[model samples]
Target: MEQQEVKTPEAVAMLDMLKAVPQQGKFMFGHHDDPVYGIGWDGDSARSDVKSVCGDYPAVMSFDLGRIEIYGDKNLDNVSTDRIRQEVVAQYERGGMVSFSWHADNPLTGKDSWDVSDSTVVKSILPGGANHDKFMGWLDKIADYLNSIQTADGTKVPVLFRPWHEHTGSWFWWGQNLCSTEDYKALWKMTYDRMQEKGATQLIYAYSPGTEPKDSTEYLERYPGDEIVDLIGVDAYQYDKDTFGQNLENALTIMTQVSKAHGKAMAVTETGYETIPDSVWWTGTLLPAIEKYPISYVLVWRNARERENHYYAPYPGQVSAADFVRFYEHPKTVFAEDMKQFEKKK
Candidate 1:
C-alpha cells in the first residue's frame, strides 16, 4: 500500500513505522498505563507490570484522557495528566509509541461516558447545538494536551489518538443506538477538524469499534472516511475462554480485509483475559489468535492497583509470568528495546 499523507512529519514517520511492523513479521506488544502504575503500585516512575514479568517495557503504551474534557487534574482512573505527559515523553525517548483514548463525559446529561439516558447527546454537541460551544471547549483541552507532549528540543511526539471507540456498543453515550450514523460520522469529522485547526498535528487517528461487527459491511457502518483515518482497529475482550479465539480471529480477519481495502494499518486496539486465570494465556491463547494476522499491535487493558483481579498482563510471581517471559522472548513480539531499530532508521 502507498504511504498515507498526514498532517505532520512526525506522524508520517510514525505511520511508516506502524505499516512496516507486519511486513517485518512482527507485532508490537502493548499494555495500557504500563509505566504509569501497575498491579500493586501507583505514581512510581519507570515501573511496569510487563517489565516486571519480562525485562522490557511495552513497545506501545496506552493512556486514557477520560477527565481531560472536564479539565480535571486527574483522569477518571485517577492518573494525573502531568504524570501522563512525563511518562509519554519518557516512552518516546525510550523509542516506544504511545496511544490515547478518551472517555469524555456526556455533554447533555453532564454524566459519565457510560450514561445512555439521553440519546440526543451526539446531536447536542454538533454545530449550532446548545452544547456545541461547550464541547468545543472540551476539544480545546484535548488539543492542548496533545500538543503539549513534546521533547525537550521542542519536537512533538507522534501518538495514536482513538476517540469515540466501541461505538457499536450501547454502553457509552455515543453508541450506535444512542446516535444516528450520520451524526456519529459528523461528530468524528468535527472533532478531527477542530484538532487540526488547533494544531494537534502530531496524531495518527485510529477508528476502533467494538467486536459486534461480524463483517466489513457491519464494520463500516459508522466509519468516518478514509481520508481522516490512519489506522483501523477493533476492541474485543475475552469473556468466555472457549469462544474467545475464534471470535477474535473472525474480527481480525474482517479488520485485515477492511484495512487492506482502505490502505490503512490495523491493530487489536484493546484485548486480554482479565486477571489472567490461565497460566499460559499469553502464548497459548492471545498469541495464537493474533499471530496469523497482520496487526501492528495488540494492547491489553491496565492493571488497576486498587481493584482485585482487575489486571490483564502478568506481574512478578503471577501464574502467567513465566509464560509471559516466553511471550516476550518470542521473535514475533517486539518490545521497547526492539523499537530502537525503527527509531534509528526514522
Candidate 2:
C-alpha cells in the first residue's frame, strides 16, 4: 500500500489538556438516531452500512481491534497483522478520525482460552494478579500494531485506544468479576507503559469505567488517571425501549459529569436498544436523548449484525446521514472548540 510522512502536532499535553477547562462540555454522551439514519437501509448487513454512517461521524469506531483477535498462535505475523491493518487504515482514511474499543480475556498477547469471557479465561487473570506476564505481553503486541500505522503528514494514527471499557459493570473478563481495584490499576498502567515504550504516541488513551457506580464519586474512582487518558466516555444499553430511556439519561449525565470532571471530550462508545420487530437505534432512543445533549461523536457498535453482537445497527430502513447533519449543525449544539467540520450536513 501507500505510506505517508507523519508529523506529530503539539497536542495539548493530555494532563494539561484536562486542565484547560473545568472538565465539562455540552452534548457529551451519544445514541443511535434512526437505526437506518446514517446507515441508510440494507437489512442487517455490517460492512455495507460502514460507508453510509461513516459520513455522519467525526470519528469512526474500530470495533475490529476491540472485538476481533489477531495475536498468539493465531498465526500472527507481519502478513497477518499487515492484512488487517491495511483494511483498518483504509477504513480510517475513509472515515477520518477513528476511535477504537476492544476486550479479550486472553492477556494482551496469547491466542488461548483467555480470549473468551468464559469462566476459565476470567478466573486465570483475576485480582492481585495471576498470569501478569502474558497480559503485559499481549499489551506489547497490541502497542506494536498501533505504532505500525502512519498518517498523511507522516505521523502515527492518533487513536483513542479504549480497552477494557465499561469496567464498572460485570460482563467482560476484565470487569469487576476478575480483578480488584489495585490489580485493575496495574493492568491499566502496564498497558499504558508498554504502548509508550513502543513509541505509539499517537494514542489518546481513554479509561471508560462503567456508569452503574453507587454515585458520581464512585465513578471518578474508576479513572486510572488523566495522565494516561485524553478523553472520557461511557457505554450503556437497554434491552427494551423503556429501560433504554432511563439508562440513556443516566449514561448522558454520567458521561457529561466524567468528561467535565476530567476536562475531556465525550461520546457513547457502545450502545444497543432492541425493540420487538425493529431494534430501531435512531428514532426510538438516540434521537430523543441526544436532542438535549451536545455530544462530540456517536459511534454505533462497528459490527453490522450477529446474534452475539450487541454493538451493531441494522442497515435496512436505516436512517439517513441527513438527520445527523441537521443535528451536527443545530445552532445550539456545539461539537468542540477545535473540531474540523469537513463534511457539510447532508
Give per-model TM-scores. Answer: 0.97, 0.69
Q: Which segments of candidate 2 are over 4 A away from where they belong?
A: 1-47, 50-58, 66-84, 91-95, 108-130, 274-281, 305-311, 316-346
Candidate 1 global TM-score = 0.97
Clashes of each: 0, 33
Candidate 1, 102-181: lDDT as tens digits: 99998898899999999999999999899999999999999988898899999889999999999989999999999999
Give the whole-model CA lDDT for all candidates, comma-separated.
Answer: 0.92, 0.52
**Residue 189 lDDT, candidate 2, scale 0-100:** 76
- lDDT per residue for candidate 2 within 199-313, as digits (tens), equals 7766777767655765567776657777776776667665666766677677778767777676667665666543223434455457677556535555555332323333344
